[model samples]
Target: MSLRQRPLQASNSTSRTTSEPPGQPTNPTQPNCHPSTPPRKGIRLNRILGRIVPIILLIYIAFAYDLVVVRYAHRHLYLQRRRTLLPIVWLLPAHGLFLWSLRAYLRVFFAHSPQYTNKSSGLISWLRTNFGAAFPDPDEAQQLEQQRLNTLATSLSNTEVKIELCQADGQPLRCWRDNCRARLKAFRMRHCGDCGTCRVGFDHHCAWFDNDVTAPATLRAFVAFLASIPPLYVIAFGPLFPSAWHTLKQIKDFTASDAVIRSKWYNKWYSWIGGPAFRWIVGYALRASRWPKPSKDRWPHESPRTPVLVALGAVFVFVATALAASSLTQLRRAMLTVDLERAKAYGKLRLQMEKLEKLTNGSDVEKLTAIRQKMETLSPTQYFKVSTKDKNSGEEKESIVALSPEEGLLSRGSAWANIGRFLGLKQASSSDGPAWLLSEPALRKILQAAALLPRENSN
Candidate 1:
């Protein structure tokens, strides 16, 4: 039998029915099948409350005990007379450093940069459509999809292919190819029909600026990424360290006089400053106070100051290294523009384009147009252009130009460069060339340097 002439199955086999035994009545109000409910706003609210309430309560209790119990006991026993404000002094800077490190860590983990935003939203949506629908078990599917996407993205860096093209005049076109090196180092790539070249590290297509994000904007983005560390560290570590140390010590031995004194200080400090004080101030104060004074009597007990200073120094060094590496990479990318321009001056750029045209099949015009339209909306300038264009126009003419190697290279670097400028960093220039500029690896490295990745299974 022909495929179209295959037998049809009974609809009743798949369909639900309300038939029942004698005396039973079907409930008309009930849904045909229980519809899956979207997670409610209250569920998110409860999650937030659950996480926040305990931290808040613990902080509150610490402060209360220090004020009502520790202070009263110290005053009653005249132990407050020998106390020097020196502990507070050390506590302040120490606390500040701890908080700074914490802030840096959290920022690395939770802070969203445009680069991160693009990757996450794209990945999440892709996973949702691909895996979410294909698998029967939604939760299991999501996990599998996430793992698959990450693996695919990592693996794609090594794949290389040569694209062949032909000229419009029926001349045999040459092949255009990029090696594994380029693919591995690329932040992203964009195909621009008008320019007839593939740009690398393309940040975003900006129609409003009439330019893509290049040079300065990319630098700015890096700066912004770096800047976020200080604040995030403060938020994560400022209260957490001091509160944690005091709490831990309290657990081990409640009778230590030093613990009692530190406890008193924490209570007053929390009340006076917890509500609105800047994170830096709180951190500084915490660092200055000596809870358990340096004791040479025990082999395992190292000087508290040494560990605190070492940690702070390590963090600072990592941040510095990341900043330097990112800056150098951007410089190298800028230099590529000059190289490309020189290649174009020698007619190589045109040759490469001709080659690309020869090797590939006719343009996937519909796919290209759709991709361009999607990209245009991402930028302000493109948004305006889209708004101005008539919706009914099925075909919009695109200007095609042969770019000099420099122009081609610049086009590739422009996206990240623009992001840097947006974040207030110096623009990439033609004189400097580095491999690290605006690449995803560089971004990931910066995050790692900032200690953004979880050290343990926080969840």
Candidate 2:
């Protein structure tokens, strides 16, 4: 037995699902121990910044709203036209997108994601009890979930209910988290140190949102908020687009000074950074400072709030766009940010082993052995212990087996389907069970790979 594992309680259930090699030894835990990330608010960087980021974002958003809508778009210059309603029409979509993003942001802030308890039943009950089709309003559903789950856990604690957890190969799927050992876990289900809760479809603990973004609930909103930024900015800056474009064009040419401004855009201070990108950024500041009213005197009498806000907004939009693209691309590949990172490490480990195998002669057996051990450690195959009762003796027996990594991944279907399923964009029927898990056929393939499907007569 591993040092991390504890002896499980005996159950009244006598069902034996399988009688063969489950998959791998069924006791090995996930590599990420709680202490490494710490299962509580342990003065981590994300924990500290999470509180500050949303406040910063809200302030920025307020500033941006004041500058763009209140100051610019809502001005007489844009809406002073004869057909004022037509000119103000563009603000509709901008406001919609802004509100949508805001809604999503608040959803993240409130931890409106579908969270599962650290129990086997959480796998199924989350769909029913969490913020989904049944409970559509996230504001009400979010906080009550924990209380509801606590009540459920208390009610079910002493019952004779079996905590069934089977991986792809019909082996026990063991979670080593202190809170989640008895819970049914979907693939990619992980414990968030900051939240101190196990999340299925765990994406990343976003410091900006100050919350964990679990899939099938909050992932949809998180990505939607990010993706809507560019369009929101575009619509928000309808009439001001020309001036904004001109400023950006000016910013592009580091030495290109505005004819109206007295001082040249070129300055020795711009070259202080000694990088082209840095120099161009300095140029934007200089150009914005020089931006004047449509008059002979192009120098600004006061602070250039419009140009500065525009520049700042551009930075936010750029970051949001890149993040959105990166997130979607990973989801399209049927992977979370965590899975992608793990896959990279696995790939590197595999490559090192291959190189070592080819380079080393028979004399360097120890080095090769060490590499082989690392490969197995990195392998997707993992174990969990299962207790089964013998029919004849009526005695319980414990054994271990491994499950395939593919079972957890669910990367076998069409790419679009995979993305839709992971995002919970697909409508599910009651019979479908959970989209977070693999289908029966998918499980059969994994089981056959290990030749460990249970016998029909074993019941």
Candidate 3:
């Protein structure tokens, strides 16, 4: 879940304490456990930063809007005799894109509808979706989640896969990392430390949005917002293209003249005052602003701040492109943001396994030894509890199985199928048939590639 840009902790603690802030109410069933440990300062800091990041981002966006629309289009272009109507032409689609992007931005930040399906959070969630469909409806999602799990259990019923995510006594898994034992009902649920809840399709907690991007609600909007950037830039800058080109020429010309750097008033005034870095920055600003540049009657299009619009627009374009690409790549692979981080750790093990496969067994003793040493250090990222049957007694026993190098935890096969699920594009199936999979981050084909597990688990 990008607007940019955990290992399985199967905790079995049944402590009744809810993870609330210092001043908030604690769980009445459990005794207070605060005195045993010092309060973590990091949590308080994360709270402060999360609240302000979106505010700062909005401020930045607002500044760009003013610079582009008010300053350049209205003020400068209107004054230009032949171009009076050009601002309207440029701003019509520009404003449309801007409003659409703004809506998507807010949706990305706060539209966690699927997570709010319960009576407590129901009304607001309905309002967020206009009391209509965004993606997966709450009732449908719950049904789908149950169906997916049932099918999964059925498939692994008689298999030899050693899974490890069983709660010791059918109790809920405690997320010690977040200091919460909240029930995670959503598909592929992960507890977001910042949000203080397990979000449905929980991706990562984005610091910039100050929110979590759980799919079927915020994922589509996040992608839409990023995708709008290039078109928005093109529309906003269409009329100002000539002026921008001229400004680039001024900067280029300014750089070639050594005399301008040492003698221009913009450069000379603060040259000694700011040590060197600050003065260098001021010089860069001058290149875009004042060097060989002022007309007899300078318009807002020729203002020093014009470069700010260009630079910001260029940067957002690049950022949106990169973040969008990264997100699509992950979605196509059937993993969310948190799953991607887990993959990075396991990816190292896969590389070694591939190398070992190429060489004959025991052919190079040194290479084999080095591979073993590396594998020992890089333990499997996640463990799942697969039920093993005792052949004679006909009883099932659960064993914690580590992921083999070639296997992944989230994939449900084909890219199209994965993306269809990620976007929540598929409608719910009949309750009798297999419902749409929200995500299979539980266990990919964990047993299909079981040959390496025996050796790696030994390591």
Candidate 4:
């Protein structure tokens, strides 16, 4: 039998009904018709808190130690040494370099676009539809779904065509022979409208950067985090190196003499310059500065004169910056390579050539050849003349529903929200509504796909 003669099989048996199409609207008299709710601000806040609280606590502790403990010790020492003009030469540039590096980090993070969210969503929707399961199983169900998709594809390709005449610019034009011809043309493809998810790369939806953390923006943010290391290390260690060294050695506690405290403060002078030039000067000063004496030194002349701690800190900063720059460059190169590969692959599938081949049936091959010649005369971009309206009714309709603010902010779109909004939250404030009330796990799974959080790191 011809492929077109085969009966169309239902994509799913349980979820669909014989009376209505999949995802079709139901009668108002139907019981258990619950509408979904809009996502609550409280749920969003909880998710944000879950991810942020631990990091915030760590930062708070670190800040408290620096402000309360470190600063207090310095004050008690009454370090009243004259500001040395020699160190200022090195400090200014070092400070500038650190700031410049930080700015570069922020720039990279913000430059990343959220284009990948749509792609990921499309992939997910394709899997869900083709598999014929809300969640795929490894057994017989998965195999059945795959078979159905293959059958559907083959049937679509083999369907017989009939010619019809249409008036265009007062001239007769040939068009397709199908019942839903207008809808098929409107969507550009027949099956796409029936598919559950939006087509990836074909359609772009607004994406929340936080939802797709692996998106360019998130990756850029990660890169920025990495780039921040050198400057942060330098700022933390440059002036504080001597004090750190003293603390580590159990030599004079931060409760030291005024001269020693002033010396420690002056040692970090390179931090003021804030750039590479400042770094060079700071390195030089650290190598030249005298080391502080130990309280229990049996022999005064035996103490080391070199500022070893300061020299080491400068070396660490330079090495860190070099590594971060190299890594960022490599990552950018890899992403560009992948994009080029995808473009090359897409270019090979010429839809116009496929259309021409479809027209060449029986002995009318020469007629089809002439049509192909005419098609080739047009520019590649102009080859596919997509009409804005259905030829019969001349009414233009959107293929995909545009997302609204509430629906656009989360999930694939408003489909999930219908259920959430239907369930009114009388017990809690709108802001405190729990995510669990709106299928928390499924929402989280979608958000995770969007990359709002770090991916599971196996290593």
**Which predicted model would earn the best TM-score?**
2
lDDT of 1 by residue, 322-387 (tens): 754555454445432223333334354344444545665436555444433332222111000000
TM-score of each: 0.25, 0.64, 0.61, 0.26
| Candidate 4 global lDDT | 0.32
Question: Candidate 4 lDDT, tens digit per residue, 1-459?
Answer: 000111111112111112222235534432212232222233444345535643553464355334322342232222223334433544456456556644543333232223333354565444423321121111232243334333423423432211111111111121122222221121101111211121211111112112222222223333454566566555544555555454434333322433544465435665567776676455334433444544543222122222333444466457557755654443333222122333344343345456656765434667555444433222111001111223465443211111111322122224323222212223321442321121232223322332222445659
Which residue pairs of candidate 2 clash? Answer: 23-402, 24-401, 24-402, 26-383, 26-384, 26-385, 26-401, 119-183, 120-183, 120-184
Summarize candidate 3's per-residue lDDT along 161-219 as a digit string, tens digits: 22333232222223333333333233355556665544556777766566667665577
State the lDDT at 100 in candidate 4. 60
Q: Candidate 2, residues 9-58: lDDT per residue as tens digits?
A: 22223223455532345434523222322234346888889989888888
- On lDDT, the stronger of 1 and 4 is 1
Q: What's the C-alpha lDDT at position 197 in model 2?
A: 53
Better of 1 and 4 by TM-score: 4
Q: Model 4, poorest ten-residue lDDT window?
A: 1-10
- For every candidate in turn, the CA RMSD to the true structure comes to 24.9, 9.5, 10.8, 22.6
Give the lowest summed-lDDT range of ten residues in model 1.
Answer: 380-389
Indicate which candidate wins on lDDT: 3
Q: Which regions of candidate 4 fall more than 4 Å away from where they truly are? A: 1-34, 40-90, 97-222, 235-239, 251-459
**lDDT (C-alpha) at residue 189 in model 4:** 11
The segments of candidate 2 whose C-alpha lies over 4 angstroms from its true place after superposition are: 1-56, 77-83, 112-186, 193-197, 247-270, 286-322, 356-377, 382-401, 405-409, 443-459
